[model samples]
Target: MHVVVNAATSADGKLSSRRREQIAISGEKDFARVDRLRADSDAVVVGVGTVLADDPSLTVKDEQLCERRREQGDPEQPARIVVDSTGRTPTDAAIVDDAASTYVCLSEAAPVDRRMDLADRAELVTAGEDRVDLLRAFAALEAAGLERIMVEGGGELIFSLFEAGLVDELRVFVGPTVIGGRDAPTLADGDGFVAEFPTLTLESLERVDDGALLIWRADG
Candidate 1:
């Protein structure tokens, strides 16, 4: 399976404010590019923190793009996957709507009631004991035919994917704005790597709506 991570960050390398509020860092052109990326992927993945913070639909928004996907014998929108260790995803979250198939990755430690409730709306995949094991969760996704997975993350999830050596590519849109805060979420936010940091090969760089788009391929 191919895992591609995409994010939009301020010039200061912050994904959002320190308060974890969602902000508009990218412009219209970047939004369109993200829509296209969603339309082309088999599934979109995010962490539970993102769900609680932004509550994004994670569906392709362009009608034309949906049509194109349909013509290619694909679903109107890609599947949505959420990595929630303890099943904190709200039952009414947009990702669980009928617009697309939804999968919530949970751990065995999740409350039975919450798991049952979410199971009514979204498929539940148990991977770890205390936390959602990304490796096992992704393996299950791959077995379900979700080969092209796009990760639209908060920060911790992104770091976990890199730490697990599961990320294949990364595409970042560096917007013109500067959101500066010591506690602000950056592109990858987990325990900082001390040694053996992930390496990347620059694939392409281009100017997009008042911003720059940078693409990199993970080096093994």
Candidate 2:
């Protein structure tokens, strides 16, 4: 399976949406890149916090991105996946009601009753501890035939996924503007492991419009 991470950050390396709102420093080109990635992916996933905050459709809104997807096979919109460890995504949320399909990855500890209630509109899968199991979640998606995944992250989710060593490619567009806040979010938080080192290798770097793009791969 191929996993791609798409992130937009400010010059100061803050990933948080300014004032807790979308469309912060990141510009059109960067958003288009995200749309294109989603157009080319089999699934797009984000954390529950993002779902609650952004309320995004997660569909390819760019016309070019849509056309490419059609030429490639008229692919159905990428499945919207949410990691709602506590089953907190409201039943009426657009993530469940708007997409052709929405998959909620919750913890095994989450009650099955909550899942059953939403079965008609959303597919719920159990995955991590009191949280969605990142590894098993990917395994389930792979088994279900989603070969490529693009992760649109919120802080904790990115941290957890990277900590689990699950991402195959990382893409970030650093916008020229800076939004500085002492506790603003970052693309990835430190993993809890008391480790000597992590073996990471940079794959490529380039400038996309006014933003910078970075790509990386896991060690092995």
Q: What is the TM-score of each predicted model, taking all chains together? A: 0.99, 0.89
Model 1: residues with Cα > 4 Å off, grouped in runs? none
- lDDT of all predictions, in order shown? 0.96, 0.79
Backbone clash pairs for candidate 2 read 127-133, 128-132, 128-133
RMSD of 1: 0.6
- lDDT per residue (tens digit) for residues 54-141 in model 2: 8877887877777777788856587889888878777888878764578888887777777776676788778777878889988998
Top of the candidates by TM-score = 1
lDDT tens readout by residue for model 1, 128-150: 99998899999999999999999
Which one is best on lDDT? Answer: 1
Candidate 2 at 176: error in angstroms? Answer: 1.3
Candidate 2 backbone clash number = 3
